[model samples]
Target: MRGNLATSLRRRRRRCPIAQYDRLPPELRRWLAQAALPWSPVSALRLWHKLLDETAGNIEAARQRLDLIEARMLMRDAPRIWGVPPTVPPRQPSPAG
Candidate 1:
């Protein structure tokens, strides 16, 4: 299954029910719809809550943050999976305000 596909993130052998998916925030559901990786509800919701707080409830910002994280993971795994060097530099954290 796609959920069992190899990724930079560790794989978990568990079942995710539709009820779990239905309980996700609408914004997160939309984000997951287009996500390149199949994210489990538990992990996705964990990151969603973290990013929501970090972005001060700005949904779009959280979405972009997810994109950046996925991009970094793909880049990190490229050499191992695809045998190609990463094309982009790792994102640097912004200075604290």
Candidate 2:
């Protein structure tokens, strides 16, 4: 059935390591390094998610202030992949919608 197929697909996708830092700006990387330290497997992952959400919010706010249409455009066009959702709600609906 369709449900079974969807479940199987989800399982396959879950095996892939989602890319959380691939497109991070250098400044954001510096922020993350500072925020996420004394790394243990569990704590490191929690820190990474927290940093990613904070970084995304800051970037979106900057784009709003500067009225940089292209910044919004680039963010809009970026690919959606498996990762933690931002702490802030996304400006647009998710692709899964």
Candidate 3:
């Protein structure tokens, strides 16, 4: 896994500074720290805002929704990156009831 990262496609982009990261919501900071994907602040914030709107600002719900999204992304990338075929279709998020 460590060796794979060295050969992964690198995106040309500026990085968010630690001070700027400190200004993000504490919950988001925590989530980013432990997230499976290396999400940029701008992209994550955009999704976070969308989740907040969808969940009526429920932080836990937003976090769970984010996890579902990340899982789908991982499943989509697994074949290309790890040469592992997906055993099952990725689960779609259920409509909010």
- Poorest 10 consecutive residues by lDDT, candidate 2: 35-44
Clashes in model 2: which pairs?
A: none
> On residues 1-97, what C-alpha lDDT tens digit does candidate 2 reach at each position?
5667656354543322224443445544444455423323343445445644755757545323323433454456544533544577558866994
Better of 1 and 3 by lDDT: 1
* Count of clashing residue pairs in every prediction: 0, 0, 0
Clashes of 3: 0
Off by over 4 Å in 2: 1-9, 12-19, 36-97
Q: What's the true lDDT of residue 61 in model 3?
A: 99
Candidate 1 accuracy as TM-score: 0.68
* Full-model lDDT, candidate 2: 0.45
TM-score for all models, in order of appearance: 0.68, 0.24, 0.68
Better structure of 1 and 2 per lDDT: 1
Regions of candidate 3 where Cα sits further than 4 Å from its true position: 1-16, 86-97
Q: What is the C-alpha lDDT of each candidate?
A: 0.89, 0.45, 0.89
- Pick by TM-score: 1 or 2, better one: 1
